[model samples]
Target: MLYLTINETNALLRTAHTDAFHLEVSDDHSAVADETEPMRRVLAGLPPFEPDAYPDSWREWDELVGEVTAHGVTMRRVRVVSEPLTDYVRFLQGLTDRNVRLGEDIRWLPRHLVDQADYTTDEWWLIDNARVAFTIFGTDGDFVGAALTEDPAIVDRCTGIRDALWRKATPHADYAPGG
Candidate 1:
């Protein structure tokens, strides 16, 4: 297992054109609550991030595709986006249109799903391709995301929990939201 802060992960995404990798994301609502707003921009063929240099996700997406096409590793992402439907559709469309498969779990529920004690308040994700997992807060700088590898048993346990959540997750379209 490896540890990476958000910046490290972003860097990996940027330069890792040769390695095939899958990115499984647990939608971090603690930071961005409006999925549609981002999707609206993306569907318009606009960049997903702000107008900053690194804010544009196209380069990262292109690099990720290079990994998949070159290394047989398809980038798979799972997100539970709060929605007004249109943004969810747009976001899903962008992800699905890429070399990535995007899906969602119960985290999109009107109420939060994970226990506060079980996971921190930050956004979390497990990169199955690298077998590395970690979490990042919305407001944290790119360097704030922590890589988990301190304890093998504990990391494996968390991985299992993530898998369980994945198994139980439904497609975003199938979700009832308030249900």
Candidate 2:
């Protein structure tokens, strides 16, 4: 039940030896300062930046994903979104190809496809199937911190949820927003 700063969580994530899974449940994370300008550009109909010219934070994340995957650590993410597609989700969709190129498998699931009671509402990352880091966000969608836990029961439940959703979600290549 220990809470960790974002940096701490990143360090923990970098330690994953086998696999890492991310579950995103929020439609808007506008309060993330780094994404503000990029999201604005997306909303204005500007095309995404070329991969070599990505913003610093994005470049760093891309490098990390590349490095991890090159070492055989599998990285996957599932985003459960409500449609007609929030501008933020659309922005993420625009970035999906680059993410896949960097070696992460990304999927999109329409929220209505699953029973809400089947999973916790919090966003989380399961690292190496051994620990769960739950992201904590403010009411306005600002990420505050993360809570890391190794309690087997919680880990098992999250693992089950991730497996179920991953099977039902559409791969990014096949997902058509608002279709």
lDDT of 2 by residue, 13-84 (tens): 789999999999889887787787778777777766544657877777877888788889999999999989
lDDT (Cα atoms) of all candidates against the true structure: 0.45, 0.86
Residue-level error in angstroms, candidate 2, position 114: 0.8
lDDT of 1 by residue, 1-179 (tens): 46676556665544433332222333333234434456667878886568564333556546545654455433433443334434444365455533333212222222255343333323444444333445544463222555644365654655555555555555445665442
TM-score of 2: 0.90
Clashes of each: 1, 0
Q: How well does candidate 2 score on lDDT at residue 100?
A: 93
Cα error, residue 177 of model 1, in Å, equals 5.4
Structural similarity to truth (TM-score) of each candidate: 0.49, 0.90
Superposed Cα deviation of residue 99, candidate 1 (Å): 6.0
Query: Which 10 consecutive residues of model 2 have the lowest summed lDDT?
Result: 45-54
